[model samples]
Target chain A: MKKIFLSLIFLAILTTGASAQVKMLSLPQLQKRISNPDTVYVVNFWATWCKPCIEELPYFEKLQATYKSQPLKVLLISMDFESKLPAVKTFARTHKLASEVYLAQRKSDQELIDAINKDWSGALPGTLIVNGKKGIRKFQEQEFTYDELNKLYQTNK
Target chain B: MKKLVLLMLIAVSSMAFKLADGGYKVGDTAADFKLKNVNGKTVSLADYKAAKGYIVVFTCNHCPYAKAYESRIMDLDKKYSAKGYPVIAISPNDPVAEPADSFEKMQELASKKGYTFPYLIDETQDITRAYGAKATPHVYVLQKTAAGNVVKYIGAIDDDTENTKADKVKYVEGAVNALLSGKQPQVTATKAIGCSIKWKKSA
Candidate 1:
């Protein structure tokens, strides 16, 4: 029984260390989530290769943890090329990113960029803080400090 | 006091909006700059007196998107330089933020690639800011006019970022071709997913 318990613990550790499975999200699916009235969605467009995106990830994770009880959901959308899915998965696992992560599936980069925000200019590390309830939609194409992110949530919430 | 406060709010909101909408629009005349090139020589748009126009590309060594488009940029220079539109690449990323984009690394890459065009370094990023380049591989095609260099096209090199050879609509080529044919480019501006310009931390 003790050996079995030890093995279970080891398995649990391995599973936790592995990256949480990521789902493929179409533009429509992403739009639906962003437009949902019940929840405040903090959608971060990132890629495994973007340095600033990687650097600013912890802030998003902190936002997720702080608002665990609230209706705030942090969605990390990986903009890595579809062919680099393995790299994306590896990056998520290596970073041990806790929030819900996804790989974007779309017809083209232009379509995706336009769908997200016309002014985005297709830059990585772009963030969208949307509170459908308050009709508050803010988009920034730069990295945010944890304090700035917290303040954004407080103001929007 | 209420009127003053209302004006202040409007000003603040407008400033915020402008910050988000930063960068050059199509038809805006872009400025010229004297920047250090990889060949240990200073380069400027005016230096190319023989050329009728320029293909100014903001690209770097570090970004994957930039790397993927390297051959295409070289090809653009090769095909068009003699035709009076030479490719002038600028590394716009702050070296402090992205170590790989430092001048030395740029030199190494240029040597390895045997780049025919000048690869200038936007060290202070003043040129980048002036041109409003938000991402790596951002392109601006300028046509020389009686007044000055007129911005004919601004944006991505092509429609497809993944496969350059497979791209159906080569935006840069199309814009340049249109210019050569004495017609306004069908598509003046475009956007593609790319690494954001690595900016220096502001005090």
Candidate 2:
């Protein structure tokens, strides 16, 4: 019984540490991820402090689950400041965000926002759906519902 | 005759759609709105009879970006109000969507911050929609012309959204100063990362 309890605690710590691992990526690296021809990338730009971004996160999660069989990738790219990396990791772990999460490794918000999409106004909750194989891309700078997200994916796919 | 009428209808509808997509672009005349201020009075641009122009800012209490620029906004009002340009802040977020942005909270924040400018409530969000405000702290510097209120600038208050306030390009102030000096603003617009406005659910 003692051995089992000790192993369980160790396992819990491992999982917690694993979940807290958030990758940091530059704009070019992120663009490369989206350019993967085999996968459809639904990259969502959000921050832990943004309420609307948090509100629309579940829809992205649902999209990931619904399209699990397909080569659909939902990337939650956090725009939180570099100083807030610990907070981003904590948020990812607490939310149990199964999707691959990354923090933007850019110097200026303007550069990243413009590179992602010129139409974007550097607002939180920005979403970009890209199917590199099909050469289809859509960007929206607003909160989205599950239906809207799913429809965008399907249409883009 | 029927085909001509149908063609005209399509053209009109397309024009309306384009208008809906855009709000007041630079040089476009801005519309006036009567909104309730935190002091329990209806405030309008027309009410400021002595004003030469207006600095219309769509901001809220809850947004971190807006909070960061609070002092800067107050400073703008203080510096410009006596010079015939006043800052008019409007809370554009729906109260139901964001309770922290409600009217009472606005009044509370205004009193707490000792804001000299009129902090108004855009209850229906129609004023915000008309202005095409996408985020909190979005500013529209309107110059009162002989024709009407012309949008001289539309964008972030400054380049520094993180409140470092160092080496920041003050967009709104630049626009206002240019107008004051009888020259067009060099930088008419700019973008900054900000919290999206909490829009109400459409029924």
Candidate 3:
């Protein structure tokens, strides 16, 4: 009942005005974004329902803001199923997420996990920070604070 | 120049290895735990004297993936408990980190689902750490032997997380069947997406 109510509100908002666009990123598109040498990509694999992932999202936003003058981009790639895209959009809009969020509609979840980082155990709140210009990439599966995240970004950058 | 490139490659490879490290491998002896079940009874591997094996899963109430596989996990017990392998599920997430997965909630979920298996809580997370479980719904299929409970398979419930696929691979079932037929499973391990085990904050 709550889901239906939320969906109706989301649909109403969608028709009345433009909502935050949550694009489905293919594997190739994702790889391109991460491998782009122009900027460092902090790709966070998360979902709206994941508590720990939600807890750590602010730190990513803080990282993006802290290095606003630098070549850094924080991409919040949501692992939510397609049916939840409306909710995802609503979340972005309501929360006012500064980071860009893309729905990970891949061929398979395992494939997506492997594509992001082979060592990752397909856990939520996983991050892959890539600095293509520096030829460096680090994959970590843990919750992070702004300081911890900033230190990792500084090393990769 | 060649030496510098080689050094970089080495460092990168090691880092990759370390990220996926610290989990139970197939053939390793799994540790026995004395955990509290939903019935308020302390359960352990030794309690199941008649079992030939155990399907020990580290799962929690809060994870959607775990919820998706919940019925299938029950099916595993229904299919194998009489055959000597009873399912034993351990809720590994810290209640502090996720209030929905508290001991009370665990009991509520167990009763609601009418779980036939023991849904235990790892209060200290010692058993969870011992198994090196990184995600909810992570499985470790153990085969009882004179040497102790030997881990025969370590991975997901099946290939299909959504539970709607027609061609889903049952990693746990295959492993159990192999043991029943006196043969080792071909696919010993696999990876599936799941929520990370929420640990208590370090004070």
Score chain A of each prediction against the true chain A by TM-score and list the results: 0.92, 0.91, 0.85
Where does the lowest 10-residue lDDT sum fall in candidate 2 chain A?
A13-22
Interface C-alpha root-mean-square deviation of candidate 2: 1.2
Candidate 3 residue runs with Cα over 4 Å from true position = A1-19, B1-21
Write model 1 residue lDDT over A52-80, tens digit each, in one string.
89989999999998889999899999998
- Candidate 2, residues A41-104, lDDT tens digits: the string is 9999999989889988989988998889999999999998877788999999888888889999
Query: What is the C-alpha local distance difference test score of each model?
Result: 0.89, 0.89, 0.88
Ranking by DockQ: 1, 2, 3
How would the docking of model 2 be graded? medium
TM-score of chain B, candidates 1 onward in order: 0.88, 0.92, 0.89
Alpha-carbon TM-score of each model against the true structure: 0.90, 0.90, 0.86
| Model 2 steric clash pairs | none
- Error in Å for residue B15 of model 1: 12
Best by DockQ: 1
**Candidate 1: stretches off by over 4 Å:** A1-19, B1-21, B164-167
lDDT for model 1, on a 0 to 1 scale? 0.89
Cα lDDT tens digits for candidate 1, B1-203:
99999999999999855743465677877778899999999999999998889999999999999998999999999999999999999999888888999999999999999999999999888888878888888999999887788888999998778883454689999999899888999999888999899888898
